[model samples]
Target: MSPHPQEALSTPRAAGLAGILFGLLLGTAIVLVRLAVPEHPASAGAWLTDSSRRSAVQAALDLVPFAGISFLWFLAAVRDRMGEREDRFFATVFIGSGLVFVAVLLCAAAAAGGMLATAGGANQQLWGFGHSFAYTLLTEYSMRMAAVFAFCTSTIARRLRVLPRSLVWFGWLVGLALIGGAGNVSWLELAFPVWALVVGGYVLGAGSGRTASG
Candidate 1:
């Protein structure tokens, strides 16, 4: 009636690796989309007319599904690492927020992809609506969910003493920025992935050290 001995080590490795991949892919996609798309929701859909911009947006959209998958894995890894020490309230919020973030992120990508697919001869008004909707979902809605998730994650990690205090503090700051500054500040969305990258690097290093010691 004992758990597998390798469970602890395995979970950290999976979480660390998946988190790193999620951070890299998501950050790259966000940069690409920002460069290609207008920040204003009601702006004219002029980018649709440019083939290079279209290609960049398409490439960013293509990375989204993979990023989402990696994020799911990373979520699982984090939850598993928490084990029995996980608080039920925080767990509910953490899982719920993370899932909502992925859902909105995917929905935003789909909306953008649809717009790109209809680039030629698409109705200008409709294209504008889609563009606005996609960015709204990404920057406004998804980032809010990301903020909640980050806050819950940091709180849980701090409670469990699993992560360094510096990283936990960074997570709290990231969460605050996402909550208060997401839509107004350009490039602020990058905070989520940067947090992921930092946490992932730490998890990977710690996991490696534990494995070596074992």
Candidate 2:
């Protein structure tokens, strides 16, 4: 049986919208969190005394859940776009990695929220632990999962000829940066959002044509 016409039409649009939302929210959260939390190992204690930092952290934490939701929607839309052409093995990896990424990101956000909540008591040890835990999740574990998601998505897209070759290559590059540079280079995490923005733009611009072609 043929799929519904509306399903094809809506999937790409949903992917585009979700990608845009996810990119914006994640990017903003990252910037706000970076501003709130200094990189210096010794500065962990200062967050308790700084009202601005606390507010920034709170704002970033508030954005994370929304970002994660959008990312999940984006994944669903991508799967819908793939339809019957998607290989089960790659699809499993793609969906699994994306879910793991969101889960880890939320854990990181929760740790940050805990840090903010505990800031009132000015517990230096707790603040330090939270800071380390959150950053490790954000810059290490979550990003590695994101990298796997990117690689799987790109591979699927390439095999199915869903995205342009240039875009597929770009995704690979971004995945590499996330996998290799995220731990050492703080800003490398931004590559994920940037890639999402580009993919979103492509989806928006191509509209029905790309979906039909794919």
Candidate 3:
């Protein structure tokens, strides 16, 4: 009945690719930040003075905007794939959490950028504030929102039978790790991107299979 068979098949493919891109970009940025910045900003501002660390932080900040953009596309593509099957209640949480995560991510990037710009300045207090603010936004706020988004997406995928049981369970574990310990554990943030990578790979493979069958 549909006129555009290719168009009908495109949404899942788009979602899969976008999710993969987002996960890679975001994971790289997070790794860069984790390597360059200290867990406690107040401990020492030595990274600001270290050229290599400063360069790594700068590179991380540069990747964040692109990662955020990719995430938006991934969110849109996933929502489009869900179509009429999406539950309004879970959908609201999904959309809200994703948007908030992007917002928090960007804000953290801006804070980090400001901190870098003021690295050579006389205002040590401002630098400390910015450094603390950026990490707080990233680890505390952004990750929590990411947890919510993951949970909602997994629930929707399970309901629609779009994702496998293994992925759904993995997603729940990712969500739990993020919400429960991401701020306390520096490495836990990687779970979100890793989960995204797995989900994206599966979705892309499934889409390819459908295209072949069609």
TM-score per candidate, chains pooled: 0.95, 0.93, 0.96
Candidate 2, 124-151: lDDT as tens digits: 6766777788899998999999999999
Q: What is the C-alpha RMSD of each candidate to the true structure, in Å?
A: 1.4, 2.3, 1.3
Q: Over 4 Å off in model 1, which ranges?
A: 1-5, 41-46
lDDT ranking, best first: 1, 3, 2
Q: What are the lDDT scores of the predictions, listed in order?
A: 0.91, 0.87, 0.89
Q: Could you tell me the lDDT of residue 71 within candidate 2? A: 96
Model 1 pairs in collision? none
Model 3 collision count: 0
Query: Which model, 2 or 3, shows the larger TM-score?
Result: 3
Please give the lDDT score at residue 113 for candidate 2. Answer: 84
Q: What's the residue-level lDDT of 147 in candidate 3?
A: 99
User: Candidate 1, TM-score vs. the true structure?
Assistant: 0.95
Candidate 1 residue-pair clash tally = 0
